[model samples]
Target: MVQERLARRRYGSEVGQWSGWASWSACSRSCGGGVRTQTRLCLEKVAKDNGTDSGDQPPSRAETGRRRLRPIQCVGSDKRFHMCNEEDCPPEAGDFRAEQCASFNEKPYKDRLYRWRPHYSTKRPCSLTCGPENASFYVTLRRRVIDGTRCSPDGGTDRADHVCAAGHCKHIGCDGVVGSPRVRDACGVCGGDNSTCHLVSGIFTEPHLREGYQLVLQIPAGACSIRIEEVVPTRNYLALRAGNKEFIVNGAWNIDNSGQYQGAGATFMYRRQTDTQGETLAATGPITEPVDIFLLYRQMNRGIKYEYVIKRNASLSSVLPRLPNDLQSLPPAPPPALPALPQLPARPSVVPRPTGHRNAVPAPGVARPPHTAPRLPATPAGAGQRRGGVLA
Candidate 1:
């Protein structure tokens, strides 16, 4: 029997392992669903037993007893097993639990994207429109409250109105008004304590549409000429000429609030006239000398309002004569003899009146009057003897 069993084993080896192949094919055909299900169940059982899933690295024997298993998907071209998709994975795999997705998750790279353009709205409607040709421009003038009380035109106390036409044109939405040029104040022109000159303050001229105009400010007393150092305008160029000299002032007009121009401080120079040139037909005429005058000018809407103050040198007193005779010598005086002095009689010597009171009377030793008088009984008979004898 031993000899027969040895011979049978030798025969099976020589049959090309047919039994192994047959067993594999039979298992595949007979247990297709059962084997796959069994294999998945066995993997899960092994993960639970070892504390690891097919997607995760196998836990150490010591940790396997305390850990749990997680699921994972196949990755990489080689189809090698890897840890599950969790924080413990290699950094190159990225984190799936982050709020913002990684750059790779977004579509259309930055270089391929386009930017949006901005849009603008049209301007708002204006409340006012263009005014007539003769209308004066109004400006809304505003100044921050600084050190002093509010200004005119409803500035101070909320009721006082100190605004001028020139300053009103620049105000917002003011279309300007049609009116005569009005003078704001006399002190605005004359630099003195007394602004008594009515001419100093008034609308000198009407506002016109002309580009260039001339206005003369008459000189007041106590000044010889007007001194003008500056001319400020809101939107125009100005030129000034006095005698043989001329000057130019550059300025601009603002229309955001009102449509007029106004300036605070400005000056102009003028000279008073010295002599007049009377008509003379002679070939050689008398020399003409220019007089000096002083003037002041203020820039306003439409035109410049002028205020003139004549400047005279205090040293000019030298040219005036000191004595009346010298002044009279220049011209003849009225003829008449000096009025004669009225004759007066000599005054009587003043005599003291005798006092009737005894205390005021002269003393008794001073003098006494004679008591007897001569007799005239024989005057008739004595007339015959008067030729021969002198009366005793």
Candidate 2:
């Protein structure tokens, strides 16, 4: 590879030829697989001017316009990416995309300032699109990301093996060669035989007893080329949890749509094939941490098949330690606590009412007023007899 790079550097340097490649730019990240880039120029002239060799000094922009020569396009790519700083970043260092978004934090946009966050989009893989935290809309902050950034670090991209080169997604291979055909085998070795690692696979057939989520299996740290798939579709879901017991996908009974999730120091591609009612989880990894696999058993489980590559000397027991009997089942959720009933003050007992008014008695603390009878009006003698003829 070094020799090929050196040869390309020398290819077009004879006067009026392509210029040697410029020094590579700084890496896009300090760690965690960032990119660096270098560029070359096409110096071949487009037109014969001043009766001199057209190659002798490529025409200046003004001269090219005057000559009206067809615009010269280079025969090959002028820019290329170099994968660099592949060492993993410390856990506390945070994410690279977030760092890019933070570059615009507190900066004015449309006369306003917002706490920006990285907005992922596979369509514009190399563009820096960001939005205010918790916002539904995003703004394309830059036409392209800094060269060397992964084309789509979070995955779900058609060009998973590409990176940004001069604002464009360009192919890169496991061998670090642009447009190289080399690919990693199932063992996750760039060019080694599949024999380098041992494949561990099993079909989990544990009956899901009264389910929400049930422990199915665990993939240990340092696992690579991990794949988990439902053997039969039952509208069931595959759930993943990190070593810390933090849910990675389909946790809390909330069904997540198909997408990439970050956990265990790797990106997991979780897909729900609605057409087939199938669910799958995959990752290309030597995962930095162990991950637990679970099944959301909405119905009777058919089976879940899982496979991953581990070091040749590693045993299945060591890589996938069995959970204790108590943990084999989903941890029971504490039932919602019932609120306490408020206490009421006691009421004084009421004395029985006297059976009759004769039994009623007045206490010494009260004095009763004397009772009086209602008065009646006197009637007139003539008014007592009927004045009508029938009454008389």
Candidate 3:
């Protein structure tokens, strides 16, 4: 149901483009230069559509068209004002210049010198008030026109309404405030001239569905480039539907990147099992549905490219560890601590006493004790050293 609604909205956008062509063509001629032939063709089409004759008047079609599109004017005996087709206004009387005021002729018919006298300058004031003097003039003019009274040469029309007949009107009121018109056109809203409005053929949208994956595409303003990549697992089948084509990921694939693959510097990923699905068994056993992957890229003038990939479900764990050499570096683990050893007690050392020998010789020229054992003489210890030294 969601997909159906998206498709319908896309079609509606296309229809709007066709309906706006007339306005777009007219606007292009008004703004673009050096496209004389194209502009002429566009203008002719607009004229035919609007019920105006193309070949009737001036040297330039644009000028002729402008003249034919006369501004609606309101004229009264006391004042003369211009009204666009959309709004009502009183006529203006204009002001007499200084020269005209100075040259007022008292003698009506016999003044031969009238030829040298300056004529009054009848200058129509701005429709909207700019200041106090202007406000006074506009108010007095509007009142006189409403009352059906004649104004002096120096006085203007009682009221002059400057209505912007353009689709999106910006009416500047007498109080110096600019207000939006009730009617609006697409041109004003989009700020587009003819070419821009016409170039936008249409817009399309599709509901992206991935049972357990959430995807978001980020687009920068004025960036005409975009790219998408999809990764699929090996054991479980994955399928993606984009536009009219369906893609199938045959084995464990790094469609674009993500998951454990992201740890390996991959940007996108897809998991083998649906986390939300958990261990709950479906009526049809383990769902072997193919995982769908979509890739989309767009570039200015180059246009847009969309790609899809599908793969069987094999958990990301199986695929991530098997990534190529470039992604093989895993984070280092901490060293293990040394095991503790059992403590042992210290042992005591024993010393042996020296024995008497050498035929009971006296010790160093001294007589031995009566019952004590005689000590061996030191008789050149070097000689005895030749024999076995210690207990020998």
lDDT of each: 0.22, 0.65, 0.22
What ordering of candidates by TM-score runs from best to worst?
Answer: 2, 1, 3
| Residue-level lDDT tens digits of model 2 in 63-169 | 65753454333445677767888787898987677788899986899998898888877788779988897778999998887765666654336667777766777
What does candidate 1's lDDT look like per residue over 1-392, in tens digits? 45434533553211111111111111111210101001111121343322224556675876654433333211112111111111123446332112111222233334432222111111211111111123343211122111111122212233222221221211111111112233223223222433432211111222222333232222222322223221212222223222232221221111122121111112221221112211011001011222111112122222223333222223322211121112211122332332222332332333254442111112234222211111112344333222111223
State, as a TM-score between 0 and 1, how close model 3 is to the true structure: 0.12
State each candidate's clash count: 56, 1, 36
**Model 3 Cα lDDT, one tens digit per residue, 92-211:** 422222222223233232332221222211242221111121122211111111111112222222322222222112343333222323322222222223231111111111122222
Candidate 2 lDDT trough over 10 residues, lowest sum:
368-377
lDDT of 3: 0.22
Best lDDT among the predictions, by candidate number:
2
- Clashes in predicted model 2: 1
lDDT of 3 at 40: 12
Q: Whole-model lDDT for model 1 versus the true structure? A: 0.22
